[model samples]
Target chain A: MGINTFNIEEQGFLTTKLSEFIRWAQRNSLWPMPLGISCCAIEMMAFAAPKYDVARFGSEFLRFSPRQSDLLIVAGTVTYKMARVVRKIYDQMPDPKWVIAMGVCTSTGGMYRSYAVVQGIDQFLPVDVYVSGCPPRPENLINGLLKIQELIKKGVPPKRDPIFI
Target chain B: MEEKIDKIVESLGRRNIEAEIRQDPLGTEMILNVGPQHPATHGVLRLVLKLDGEYIVDAVPELGYLHRGKEKIAENMTFLEFLPHTDRMDYLAPLSNNTAYMLAVEKLFGIEAPKRAQYIRVILNELSRISSHLVWLGTFAMDVGALTVFMWCFREREKILSIFDIVTGVRFTTSYARIGGVAQDITDEGIHAIKEFIDNFPKELEQCEKLLNKNRIFIERTDGIGMITKEQAIDIGLSGPNLRASGVPRDLRKDEPYLVYNELDFDIPVYEEGDCLARYYVRLDEMKESVKIVRQCIEKLPSGPVKADEPKATLPKKEKVYTKMEELIHDFILTNFGGTPPVGEVYHAVENPKGELGFYIVSDGTGYPWRLKVRSPSFTNIQELKVRGKGNRRDDMVGRRGSIDTVMGEADK
Candidate 1:
């Protein structure tokens, strides 16, 4: 620390920053769509409640249209028959959108594994974050948001892939 | 050609279905069938939307896609065996279904569950409520196009599921609630986990609100869309948060306190808007109340045997049932064929996270129940879509569903 301080005094303190710009953008604006499918969505609502005020993250904008959103979070199971539509929605999302595979079902097809279920949606669309659990705690989702922020900040929009419509 | 078009138009007009002069004037409006497999509709719901351009002029919701004939299936099973299937009705809020059906059976048995079990059921049911609402908010956002909230909502939901897993050894589809009471007692670690979750869950919700609650786009899309007025919602038999959103204060839990609800302090959050936003708002606030209920249950949780002392009706404890001969025989009989109930019928309801989930069971003094019918919330809740979604846009279906929060597993069955 002393050496760094001395070096900062000497060399004006060079810093290694990862995803700084994208992080700033994410911190200022994080839009999430309510992708509730089953029971997990209730906890999702609690995450946005006053006590759990999701607004503290400055990312409370849950866009209703794919064009306006930068994030695609699949909070519940993505059954086989629904995969085509999920893929289509992912396809419809404009560029610079992030996909969060929420819940064990969306991340890994959960226990609803019949002949149906696409497992993880990452096979169809690029998933930036995978929140584990039948449904994860809201804090885990917050952590996920931060991690995605880091990814977004480090991510160059052009380099990071969005489904090219 | 014009005369033929006029004749076709004349015939179409008689059907009371709107036809417009889009590019395909001779052809009817574009038909897009949504669901049977959709993320936003909550289950395998199929909506036939007749659209003029992108505007939805007519919508028809098709149910029974996920129908496993639950009512018929229920008739084949014994009273005790039917508990697990109840859990599947509102899969998102299985605890509520489990509790409601158990309460009905308890009514038939003419026995009150121990205080501890009541509190546990309340705690679990509320937790289920929290989970269900989380899902509704997350996917409603996705259906309307916001995606990040889905992840945000699920993150906190994991804690509740972990709690359920801890208490019952099952997560989403839990059949933990038994005939007389819950199968097991909650551990200290489970309580601690719940405390930790309850303590920390709010901040995460705050983070989510930062992302959504007040975005202009979200407001515009949801503000006045999919309106279900108080009268309309009541006429349609909506329950749970959906009914509360329509400015009606109807909740089976609150109006008719059963189990541990009499001891807990909570209120039904209501909104007069009755639009998507009001529904969303009511559910959002209810989550806070749920956390409060869980905290209360945690604070007031009693120490006692989890199950009731009904030898003929209740399953023996694992320790005795597995080790002792008499207990073993009892267990074997219970497993092989559940006990018979006297000829009687009971209909029980609970405020499942989705809505009011009720089970009507008729016993015939045999090992199997004569009839079992589920008055599923999702089934009734889904009917609102047809009304709430009339004259809406194509992409707006997700928003309408986001408001109602239907589950096909329960609805179709």
Candidate 2:
């Protein structure tokens, strides 16, 4: 009744294109594979916690299994050693998955311009939305999630560039 | 008999049973890799567990998945520039990290924060401790299969973060503490919020405790599990609640009073059981103790300049920097080069929510520290996993590890 916007009682049936229906379904229920690597992970948890209540956006189900999740929230610093593991997890996730680079750390390496931290996760994985903040507040992260939802609704595929090692 | 024995041996060898029997009489050892990304390890901590059937034979905790080279980065940057980096170390209690690092640097410069500033620091430290313990309680309970407790704990934690927001202007990583003092003074609204939170938080904590404190499943799962002796705890260098839970009444706050801790009257909660449950009780009691401290700090809060009057060691006020020429020059120099401490080393430790967070700074009479070493408690406390995991069931590792409350950022750093 809310997002569906249909009067099935009058028509006695509901009709929609299969692709639109799939997109709608995918847009909702965007189960996040929480790659909570560091401080940003705390904010990511807060997003799921009661105050933020990510449930309203249908992203409350934080799937630990990459195979099942449709969204990957890279929530913290992805170091060089951890990059391989992150890429492996990204690869394991099924097609039509979107990634939300959940902090400045994940988005552009943030304040840590050290030898260990990876510059940005976009080099290794396709990022759908980049949330800015050292560790973005939960609301900021929610805004990022909403942007990802918008992309899904518009039927824009997650952009992927050829990874340079 | 010899012919029969030879035939049995020959048959065993033909089936390859003889080789297996000769290699090991009992074959029950299995290797279990816990994390690096697993939720229970609490951020990028991986444990290699050697298990004999259901029981763990040994555990090897592999660190450094989240090491951003904070100490090395500290050496390169000025003292003031490195403040924010401390926030990421113990991400749960960023305020405590900020306070500890600032205290260390202030010691290096031989300048103490004003009375009001010290009281404010104490209040912030306790608030962060409660928040940190709340997260630990929620996640630890969640690990023990009490999912509702996690929700309830976070609900209370959000209130604390709101208080943090009011006072520090940021929710999570508030680098509020500076080299000689705090970033700014606390507002009336912030004081009001702290008072309100202190009054109401214990009731919410009681509710969370009601959910798990006497619950049979929670008790059975944690009561005698992952036991550590007092001697073992001390030997392994466990500080904070972990050491206190093991019957050692050693707390850096009590033993070596830092900041305004000596002025405040608070009890260090101790439990002799040294199990996961005792650790839980100790933390629960500590949150109550923190509330008491906060109340006392609010009552005894002195009205004076929040930042120290040391011009060389402390940053100039924004108003002074804009209006006065000397202050302007001082601000420029401080921002560009930072304050230069004497050519010496100072080691300062604070009783963080996790444990004893010590910072050792070596000054080459320069703005930047020659070498900065962080003695993070989680790193020392995590060594107990090897000791605790032995003889415990493989599944019990989750509750056991969670009880210790090791934040990998601090541990790996």
On DockQ, the leading prediction is: 2
Q: Give the per-residue lDDT of model 1 (tens digit) for B17-125.
A: 4334334655656666666544455555777676778788767787544444557656666777777666656777788888888888877766778889888888888
Alpha-carbon runs more than 4 Å astray in model 1 = A1-165, B1-25, B323-325
TM-score for candidate 2, please give it. Answer: 0.94
* RMSD values, in order shown: 8.7, 6.0
Residues B204-309, model 2: lDDT tens digits: 9999989998899899999999999999998999999999999999888889998889998999999999999999999999999999999999999999989988
Candidate 2's DockQ: 0.80
Number of the top-ranking candidate, with lDDT as the measure: 2
Cα error, candidate 1, residue B53 (Å): 3.1
| Candidate 2 residue pairs that clash | none
lDDT of 1 at A75: 71
